[model samples]
Target: MSLGSSKELAENKIILLYMIDKVNMPVSNHHITKLVLENKFMNYFILQQFLNELCDSGFLELSENGGKSFYSITPNGKKTLEYFVNLIPFGIKSIIDNTIPEIRSDIKKESLISADYTPKSENEYIVSCKLKEDNFTLIDLCITVGTKSDARTICENWKNNPQQIYSEIIASLTRKRDKTNRDKDKDED
Candidate 1:
């Protein structure tokens, strides 16, 4: 599984970039391994080598969490990814674009994709996606809603009442369910 040459690395770079962009998320080495295994025609060692080369080139960044390495796109890597994505044939891109999202959504619904949001304080919550290593955390916060005044109020209220934030999400879901039930009844009538 020696990458041994630049041409091999370049080929791998193309495939890896395509896979990453297609998924639209940071991917772990395990995920890449699985993809390579499924393809059968691809050389796993070559893929690994390409990944290393990309990291060296600053096109990708690797974070170790737990014991595994997770690879994320850097700004330069994103530019390279876009270049490869555009090279995809239109028909092939159409099929992949249509199918990949459905697959990713199903995986997320199954909780295969790690996601968690924790309330830190009123008007603030810690939102993170689990990476491969415990120390490597992708954390962000969301505040405000709507536009102009409505957005300002949402942010102000959220800051004042943290617990209410969670409750609001629940309330929204409940309202949606009740509305759906009423619609079903009306349809039946």
Candidate 2:
């Protein structure tokens, strides 16, 4: 690459690290793509290349969950950005700082709820639902269904109503049952 192109590439890489660091959490690949495309920082293809390169260079960590990829800046990435953040233009950095809060909130909210399905056999599918906070998983549930449609429905319900479903599940599991007549009589005797 020419010097100009190399400089641009470095800036773009720094921008990705800066964004992930500012978000300060594991953000889904989809969200990162959306943020970059929405900001017109670079084209989709280029952004993907940068993400791959960052991961390869140990500047970012990648995790897979529910078939989605999430990215977080590595400590090395933060150190690098701290050293070369000046490569990014002032206005661009300002935009990033301003844009991060809303994106962070959205990422945090979305990361809490997850649902996915995988085929178990010709006629069976397993649906997985999860609720997570920070680094902890609050709930991880899986159910098998006879059909794909059923699995999809279950996944949707879990995603849409995880809180209510969690509450109901906990209540049912912990509910106190009245003593049986025989047990009560035996105790009295």
Residue lDDT tens for model 2, 51-169: 99999999999998756789999999999999999999998899889988999888777778888999989899988899998899988998899999999899888878989999999
lDDT of 1 by residue, 1-189 (tens): 454566545555766666666776656777667665665525777677778888899988898764557777788987876666655446544655565575565434323224344465565554433222233422223443333444445445544444455456657767745688889999999
Query: So what's the TM-score on candidate 1?
Result: 0.45
Backbone collision tally, model 1: 6
In candidate 1 the C-alpha lDDT for residue 184 amounts to: 94
| Candidate 2: regions farther than 4 A off | 1-4, 63-68, 133-138, 171-189
Residue 20 of candidate 2: its Cα lDDT? 92
Q: What's the alpha carbon RMSD for model 2?
A: 5.7
Q: Candidate 2, overall lDDT? A: 0.89
TM-score of each: 0.45, 0.72
Q: Each candidate: how many clashes? A: 6, 0
Model 1 segments more than 4 A misplaced:
1-9, 84-99, 102-189
Q: Tell me the lDDT of model 2 at 102.
A: 91
